[model samples]
Target: MSDKLGITPACFTKLVQDLRIHTTLTDSRFIQLEQKVGFLLQALRHSDGVRKVGHRFQHSTSTIAMYIHEVVEAIMTSKLYGIYVHQPTPDEPTSGIITRNPKLQPYFGHCIGALDGTHNVFAVCSFDLLFLHLHAGSEGSAHDQKVLAWAIEKGFQIPGPVKYYLGDAGYTMSENIMVPYRGVRYHLREWIAGARSSSRETLPSTKQELFNLRHAQLRNVVERIFGVVQRKFSILTGSAPEYNYKMQAMIPLLCAFLHNHVHINDPFNRSTGKARAARMTMEAKRARLEIIYKRTEEALQNPAVAVDEEVDDPPEDQPEGLSMEATRNEISDRMWIDYLKYKDGPRRRQQVPDHLDELLLAFDHEGLLLR
Candidate 1:
């Protein structure tokens, strides 16, 4: 044992048992090998781990390679269930999320999943940019859009087409999703401004800000999922082996399952974050607050506009659940108005022609009244 892998007897024993690293050999060799290889696997997963310790026994590096494959399989098959995805707005109103969460069926509150990809840098030994770009050998700076494409091909979580994904300008925007127009800011800024400007506690303009703010907070589930996956598995951020692209992707997916499990299932590990997430840009936040306050006040006072879920779809397969008729009856009881005629935005702010952008200016002398 001392000469074989240079691992302490106790460490070698633990490696085989704790990490479940499978080795091929006779019983005697297995026992002997465990003393060193076991310790190596432990170290690899931990911070203070080193491959060589006093050169006690020569550690076969291939053992560690096999170790990754086994662990990734265990994580995916045993830990994860129910792929979580962002719900898109229902076109016909009778599918997917509309059937899953009945409470959310009434309000279009669950609108988007922030779609953006991120990468981690790995040391490239023999590979070049081609290898790196595919994550076989890569740096942390690979673009998110590319990563997203890679993820989709690899069967990463993909929401259906009916719902729109919301993302920053860095992401590739499409008709199925909404990315901010260049120079336009997200709604979070508006929420922050609403909170800051109002002494009225719940300022009139602040309500929409508050709603949008909540949406942003909930959507950060994806971000936290990313952070935990990267932090827990340094192998992901470390150098990539030329042949290990598949392992790299699988490892992150497993880690995401673990993180979600620990937070949602384990009582011991709670959220390790600020109670309130800090907004990124303050200037934009203030402007949003003003806009939200103005818009919310307008919305509340408008009697014609109906604030209800646009559509709901009941599943055909059910024994005893809320009936579709029941849902519609409740919605019909509410007074909803249609007043967003102006929401049909001009294609390209420039294409809207000068007449529209100046329409607000036209109303300056004739204050536009809320119906």
Candidate 2:
């Protein structure tokens, strides 16, 4: 059954059971809950149109469309979003690569998650066209910044205490948002090139370059999440259904919630062996995290660490004065100094092995050593 559906049998059964328990859908006169859920998942997993789904399920196209709407509404109204979406607390200890890297954790400890918008194109019928023209003026493509601004204007709770989402240069930096330095090598590819030719390439020569390198590394999580979603759900990568614009918008959110659900609850992924592996991973991570926390505590206890005495809240009504450029500059300067200290520290000045030094000298004579 799992092979047939492209989802594990347990997962499919769990989803059906969840819908039965949560939604108002019962055995209808024409269709049962299993058939309805199957129809919707087929369409989403395969990007099949209503006509195709109706033919496969032996139902009329309109019936298939109705069932899809019912399932989508049920999924959306469920508690998936609240259960799966997590925001890190301000005082939470840092983890993952951030904890492993001495240079980045202190600088970006307040970052919870990375945020970015993706464009999803759906077909538009004449009715949708007319409606969009009348109400919202064409429903054309929207930029990421514009969508963020609209979300803010609509009273979305922007997380804070300098806990912000990492955005790319496309976004405007604000009190609650952090972006890479403008007019600098900001992309992962640029950093990769620099790393591959570290001896030859000028290494993050300026403060802005170092900041952008670190920013790009952290912000890459958002891209990875997007890639995973697109790969998991063909509906997002392929052409979506010709639903109304509002319904189309809801599809991405529904897919995201479903992805999170499967990731968290899949039985096969949570077997005893996998559980052991996960435990081992966590233990190793915990060891690293302990070292980082101890170092951080020592640094905080040190009397040499300067504490900021001023706390000035900017005027909320004014837009111009709220720009985060000054704050970004200050952070860049501190990061630059921290990087210099790390480079000149005793750990970096360790004596090289005689064999390795000979090899390096040979490479230098052969013109293989980077300038």
Candidate 3:
């Protein structure tokens, strides 16, 4: 096959070999991956708006899609994001593991990337592969839990103990990933509310209030990552067709890889980080949270457990980004929290209200709304 207009044949072959990916190509199928990757990333950043050179190069849709897939696969396999899991070693610092060279981290340990799933909408594909397991429709937002599971199983699985993912209630707690703040009825919005209330100086704590503030900070990171993706790639800004799940799945991963690439090579990306960080700073973030509370704060009788007035509340340190397991899964086959809450095996028939009290308190807009 002829090479892409700008790339030499040798470089083309090397790029394909380096990617170790197979896909259908256009008449000029064997184009260098550098050229192909360049075009695909360009699409991710939407540099050309709705169309790019590939659109001008006259490649068939199939060929363009193939190149895009190959590039995505390569990025998924790459460890450029510095996301990895590391185990606590005998010589390791006990508190707050230093985020450093990912290469040295132990396989499957503590420094795991905190991943959460958000839906990515996309245009429909011409021929949907009915048998393909990946495309089951429903846009990507079926649930954050499923997204984390799929992500872990994909090119990257969550690393173990040393690295656990920090996600929200949307994700079910897993070994390598932790969903802190037990299915808080309120999440990003709650954090925003807490921040706003606290801005005026929230009363320190009854274990619940303190713990709530602590987890709020930790969970914000995952949300920030999602915001970055949507902000950078507007293609993900729309709702995807329910029929094409392949494109749906591709959007998030593609955007993620694009963000990482831009971070590495784009000069503009340098300021992007600094600017976003500044925007994400606590004060700014609370101001940006656009949540409309759902539950009304009608207080039911408090639990028999008294709020120990003199217990000396724990320090308001950032809550560790770990789902506090009621007990290890080994001790209980059910969702570990069910075990922690009750030793008896789970009965799905017995439904528990998700963060009921919390939801009511957080989302509910009775007297709490600011004038």
Candidate 4:
């Protein structure tokens, strides 16, 4: 059942139930809910012309078109938004993916998620690959940071002062949005090449490199979610076939809702002992959050803590370069100290073989060594 529709039979049934309760969609004498939702899913999965889909379903193109719009309206205007796309609150516990991973848990303990603008949607996604918040229907040519500002203006909330989202260089650094250090190697592939080189120098040579490495690692979640979404929904990968602007924008939001539903209810993704666990109730899933670092408001107010709550929204028209330079530098230096201690331990030997003792050097595009 999931092979063609991207959702299991059980998930499909649950979706129908939710729609029945929360939406005005009702089974008509001519077309049932099964056919309506199925047609909607097919349009999203196949991205074919309406006439082609109508032929496949043995219905008139007008019928298919009407059913698709009805389902879209039902889903978009329903109470399912709270169930599926619930925004993370300041008091909610951190994600387990961050709490369990050693590298991220230390640096990104207060990090709630990653933020990115993609496919005409600005999304904030958790490390677990669930979309926490989405602002869809932006122009494709709009700058990411500008779209983010628009999202904020439209009432997208940041979790809190201590918590932040990891973003790429395309976003500006704010108190609650940490972007990578510019003019440094920030991608995971670049770091991988540096690690695999034969020089045996595995540690980041500078604080900026270390910070960018961690930022890239944490921010890669949004990229991974986008990749998964693209693979699941063909409508996003191919050139859209002249959909109405509203329909084109709503497609991504529908995909995000289905993605979360599948993540929560797909039994094949669980182990034998955890198959029942995969069928968790929505309330239980909401309660299954992880522990977070208790960085208090008093701690933030301390002069030594370097936390700034007032630096969130910068002036709209200005060239602000690295607004949080001191904050990011402090984080990099602290992370570098800890990373150096862990990578180069006390019992490690000082001398190395001649082949391994060669200098490990990295250069920029112009061929200058990166410090």
* Candidate models: Cα lDDT each: 0.35, 0.55, 0.37, 0.67
User: What is the clash count of model 2?
Assistant: 0
Assess every candidate by TM-score: 0.41, 0.67, 0.46, 0.77
Indicate which candidate wins on lDDT: 4
Q: Estimate candidate 3's alpha-carbon lDDT, on a 0 to 1 scale.
A: 0.37
Candidate 4 structure quality by residue, lDDT tens digits, 1-371: 66677677898998888888889999988999988998888877777767878988899999988999999888888888668887888877888976886766776777889888764789989877789988788777677778888888977997666777887777777777878766677654354444434354545568787777667656666766766676677887765564787888788888888888777777453222232333534333222211001222333456543211122333332233344556677778888888677656654546332211111111111111110
| Deviation in Å, model 2, residue 168 alpha carbon | 1.5
Task: Give the TM-score (vs. native) of candidate 4.
Answer: 0.77
CA shift of 107, model 3, Å? 22
lDDT of 4: 0.67
Candidate order, lDDT descending: 4, 2, 3, 1
Q: Write the per-residue lDDT of candidate 2 for residues 59-164, one digit (tens) a residue.
A: 9999999988988887777764545433444664445556565766667666655665544221101100000000121223565566566655644445656656
**What is every candidate's alpha-carbon RMSD to the true fold?**
17.4, 14.4, 15.6, 12.9
> Which digits, one per residue and each the tens of the lDDT, describe model 1 over residues 65-167?
4444444554345412223111222442332333353323443333434444444421100000001011222344555555555545644433454444444
